[model samples]
Target: MSRSTYVQRTIRNTIVSEKSFKETLDSFLYELRFFHPVHADKMIEQAMEAKDPKVFDTLAEEASGRFGYLSFGDHKVHRYLNKFNPNRPVLESHAIALGTSPRAYSMTKHNQEATINFPLRITVTQRPNDDRASVTWDLPSSQIPNLHLNKTLANAAFFVDDKFEELIRFCSGTMDEKKYKKILSMDKGAKVGAWKDAGGPTLSKL
Candidate 1:
């Protein structure tokens, strides 16, 4: 075949392939809707007309937030929502600080039993698609905790939001090491002579 003819045929084949792929995706989405109902409805509608992967991602992200609140039974995502716009209203809360990386929680091996106090291993990863902390715990199906994991996740989100200001203040020259140490010692320590008076008897006993 001529060069022009070959190029034309290649373009035609590519178009046909894309059309076939789109058709298959449409059918799969049709079947998926039965299983997921609301999510599938939202995803399928977005997928069918979406020209970019970002659109589907947006739908998935929104659905994840909604499901997190509905299925998890609380507005966990709402607590830290202001972090995205820190200039806005501040929500004071506390959470485990894991630095720039999302917070993680896992069971550590201790005395031949699973220990929740200290994590055995920690690796940083991208933030979650939603406000839930990126923590993972060894929650066995047979031995699930009486408390919901989502509640803990929500608490973690709260901590991240609450401490952000303190962290920023420290970063932006609001709190330095010397001042912080002084504040800590002054707030927690006794007066100049309070310990000395008690120490008179304690020192004699020693």
Candidate 2:
């Protein structure tokens, strides 16, 4: 019964040419494979193997899974952020007990206290003759029945925004590789930091 609300923005031709841009985009997607639920490598492999028009949709479905949607092309990438389950332990144990997949279990109970998730998405694009690429951040809406539980999960959206902003800064050469690596290295709980008080306006809109 929970649904996601959508938010979006764009970054201009940051990369020089189409070829180089796609390569850079590929590298970025490659890095995302380190995270669970992304399945970036598998998506890429399948996309390449299919070599058909449906490849993009295949890639999107694989990358998004239950979280949301992610799609890539010669000049753009679209990400639809859904809630992320932090309690991997609980989800995994439940999966084992129920004889179901963890991913399936998480999808069913992503909003539960044992598995709170956030809503945030980013889109990157490059237009012809443009000197920069347009990057947009979208925070969707979702309902959490309990007020206390809602408050705890709300800050996660902004934290995700900050992390993506950091990634953009890294791509733009403003943030050094070492610092960016450190941010990427952080666990989910550590990433929330002091921003917990920032509140969940996006979630409230749900």
Please tell me which predicted candidate would have the highest TM-score against the true structure. Answer: 2
Relative to the unseen true structure, what is the C-alpha lDDT of residue 62 in candidate 2, on a scale of 0 to 100? 42
lDDT of 2 by residue, 36-70 (tens): 45344455566678886357444443443121223
Q: What lDDT would candidate 2 get against the real structure?
A: 0.35
What are the runs in model 2 whose C-alpha is more than 4 Å off? 1-20, 34-120, 140-149, 172-206
Candidate 1 Cα RMSD after full superposition onto the native fold (Å): 28.4
Q: What's the count of clashing pairs in each model shown? A: 2, 17
Would you estimate the TM-scores of all the predictions? 0.18, 0.34
Candidate 1 residue-wise lDDT at 189? 20
Give me candidate 1's TM-score against the actual structure: 0.18
For model 1, residues 14-60, the per-residue Cα lDDT tens digits are: 00111222232232222122133344245557666876655654554
